[model samples]
Target: MSCPRTKPAWSSLLGNSRLTTIPIICFGHLSIMVQVGDEIPSISLCEENPSDYVDLKKELAEGNGLIIGVPAAFSPTCSDTHIPDYISSPSLSSAGKVFVVSVNDAFVMRAWGKSLDKEKKSGIRFLGDATGAFTKALSVDFDATSALGNVRSKRYAIKTVNGKVSGVFIEPDNTGLDVSAAQKILA
Candidate 1:
């Protein structure tokens, strides 16, 4: 019996070759992970509340800044070590407009920020990527369902100069506490 389905363009190009692998070009949304020299995505993130949104692209457009991506808010490693390290770092003041981004709601991010920097001495802003839009825009969102119950960003640190990435530090294991640490980035 002859198959009724028409062959795809790629299959027609291959012409019945017994190739084990075929390359296909898809005209769909392609996500490219953040890298050095890449411009910050024009995605809005929430601050203290859901209604208050901040455009990161605009915020970092004219300054030296640091964007820190943590898997979740209030998590053990993130709360205890990661963020605190940046808060206490002497280099922090020079880092300029430091932002801590988490795949959480604005209320949760605000509370977590308060819990960590009680006096707000760190001057580090906590941003909420509620729908993971910002994280996905940077192509850093990971399937953290087994751990945090949903998609979360990989542990990463990006140094930006005028909204363009100058440095990218991402933990290879997705949620480790090493390469993206404040001490290393600040130094």
Candidate 2:
């Protein structure tokens, strides 16, 4: 029998690492084959911006898209290193549509988006995969019950062009890494 008060996936990822204070946390190794030629997921979700809800097909159709998956928002790696790098790095411009995806509510995503220095948000958009629908499609969703209370997605990044994944960077240890850092991808 499953416990009614089970652990949550969010709590763990947000709490697992040691990046609580830093503004730009960067992870190192990733091992996943979300390589080029793979079609990105066709999913839709509400954006923090009331007027900017995202319809994956429409958004991905526009141009190259950067889809970032995180265990949870505000987690050490996510807040301190992972996201800050992408939002601030000038090289990130190459990926046309930059989005941060987490299994959090719209409000949380919005707050997190706003927390970043205003300048960092210039080229990035924070999106809520609140329902985990998109995460399930990607096959990265995991049972993060110890802290997050339910299933959640892993920390990862993928680049898509014309709706097909061209590059995928997934943390091998499933912790923190710069799988899709602008400096590495841009060069």
The TM-score leader among the candidates is 1
Q: Which stretches of candidate 1 lie over 4 Å from their true place?
A: 1-30
lDDT at position 11, candidate 2: 48
Mind giving the per-residue lDDT tens digits that candidate 2 earns over 17-110?
6643334334633434456787776777668754556877678875888888888988887898888877777777777888888888788888
> Considering every candidate listed, which one attains the maximal lDDT?
1
TM-score of 1: 0.84
**Per-prediction TM-score:** 0.84, 0.74
How does residue 38 of candidate 2 score in lDDT? Answer: 70
Stretches of candidate 2 exceeding 4 Å from the true structure:
1-35, 49-52, 119-121
* C-alpha RMSD (angstroms) for model 1: 7.1
The positional error of residue 186 in candidate 2, measured at the CA in angstroms, is 3.4
Model 1 residue pairs with clashes: none
lDDT against the true structure, per candidate, is: 0.91, 0.75
